[model samples]
Target: MNFLVVIPARAASTRLPGKPLLDLGGLPMVVRTARQAARSQARRVLVATDDPTIQQTVQAHHIECMLTRPDHATGTDRLAEVTRRLRLPDGDIVVNVQGDEPLIEPTLIDAVAQLLARHTEAAMATCAAPIADAEALFNPNVVKVVCGAGARALYFSRAPIPWARDALADGRKCLASGLPAWHHIGLYAYRAGFLRQFPGLPAGQLEQFESLEQLRALEQGHTILVHTVKHPPTPGIDTAEDLERVRKILAQAVTAPPG
Candidate 1:
């Protein structure tokens, strides 16, 4: 299955300006993300950004980069422009890897891609992991995904779903139940044709309420296959604190060296 990994990057991050260009150890954050994407089973990897600095940084690393409109409301919209400009085939798989996740697992990328390939009926595919922390489960910033039988996403939301009514009566019981609470992973694989048509679809009410683009796809009746990843989802750099966390992770990874 042919796949293209597109990383959407923007310079005007409200929490951290020029975030895509921020240094991650010795390399630019976007370049580090592209490097991880390169490890995936993708046929090609491209960084889509509206900032010239990001484009230059990616090109300096000899990675493919596309200049897109800065006003894109969502990463999917930026990816649409990339697919259009690249003229990818309708059946080709395009994975949207967030640029801020410098530590994104390549195996998860391969898994999502393969899931999309196997489930041709699904217009898109994504990943999720079990949320072990009760706080994270309830935090609106941590999106949750409920999957139906056969791993199809039933819904995506910022609120805790499948709320265990009785468990909430005792906080300790909720954590001890061992019931899996899935946390949404930002990675996504989409058919090139569907990606091209994404921006034209009317934004769904649920999507607006949750502020999750994936919800829009669900509301439009598009099937999204969800692949479960065993590892914890990589922390995406959303602010200075997140950047520091990623730096520590990378530092440990470097010092620990594979056994």
Candidate 2:
């Protein structure tokens, strides 16, 4: 399945300003993310940005970049504009890879795209991994997903879902038997047609409350296929601390001896 990986990079980050231009190892963070996506099976990789500086930086690396309007409310909105500007075919697959995820796994990208291709009835696809600890299960920053039979996401929330009613009431820290908690990974695969239509969909109440754009699709009765990744996702840069952690991790990997 041929697909285009669009990395929506905005220069204005509330926590870390000029985040896309920040240095990651030797390359700019946005460039590093684009390079990582390039290793995927995507037919093309493009960075959609609203800042001239970001566009120039991406161009300096000889990577394709598109300048989009700065007013887009969300990354999905930015991607919709890209689909129109480039006039991608309706059936073409477009994967939304976050600009901050420089360590994103290429195979996971391929897997999500393939999952969408296999589920011809679904309009979008994403991935999730099993939550290993109680702390993450209760962490609001960690989005959790509840899936129905055949890997269809029933709901996504910041709260611990599929709540272990009896167990929790009993003051138990464990989850109910057979109910596995999974954390949602912020990656998505969409058909170009759905992506173009996304902006027009009414903002969903659930989406507004959860601050999750994907809920708009769910609220509109669209199906989202969820696939489980073989390996856990590497951390994405979100704050100054996250950036430093990833930098040290990457640096260590580079200096480590060949085993």
Candidate 3:
């Protein structure tokens, strides 16, 4: 299925300033992300950003970039402006790839888009992976998603969902059984029509409390299909440490002997 990819990049990241422009193996972080997105089956890929420098940098690399309003409250809002500018059809699938994920897998991007294409009842689609350890399950930074029957997403939050009542009350450091805990991946596949209406939707109480944008759709009675992957992709850059880790991984990749 053909789809459009929009990478939302902001110059002012709270944890890491000028994050999209930061270097990753000699290329800007946003540029690296766009390269990965280009590898996907997406018919077109565009970088939507608020900074002139970032737009110039992306264009310098021969990548498409759109300079959007800097006052966007969220990346999704920035993407809405892009849909309006492009005039994407209501049925067109638009995958929202986070600008920070330079290591994002192209295959996974295709998978999410394909998943959304098959689910007509859903307004949006996202990915999730099994939570491996108690530490990650407990960490609020790792967003979790609970999916009901038919892979319909019931909720998304920073809290440990599908809470193991017995395990937690027993003071055991173990993950829940029967129903596996899942880590919500930031990647998303949105219908162009839904994306355009996103900014106008009133912020949901659950979304504001947990700082998750997906909750707003749930609150508005929209169905979100959750696609589960067995293994999670490499973590995206969120802080200085994450950036350093990705650099080392790229360095190792460059030097390692090809099998």
lDDT of 3 by residue, 46-149 (tens): 99999998899999999999999989988999999999999999999999999999999999999999999998778999999999988888899999999999
lDDT of 1 by residue, 9-32 (tens): 988878998899898889999999
Give candidate 2 regions above 4 Å deviation: 170-173, 176-178
Worst 10 residues of 3 by lDDT: 170-179
lDDT of 2 by residue, 85-167 (tens): 99998888899999999999999999999999887788999999988777788789999999999899999999988798887
lDDT of 3: 0.92
Estimate the TM-score for candidate 1: 0.94
Q: TM-score for each prediction?
A: 0.94, 0.97, 0.97
Please identify which of the two predictions, 1 or 2, would achieve the higher lDDT against the true structure: 2
Clashing pairs in 2: none
Model 1 segments beyond 4 Å from truth?
A: 169-173, 176-178
RMSD of each: 1.8, 1.2, 1.1
Model 1 scores worst on lDDT over the 10 consecutive residues at 170-179
Best first by lDDT, ranked: 2, 3, 1
TM-score of 2: 0.97
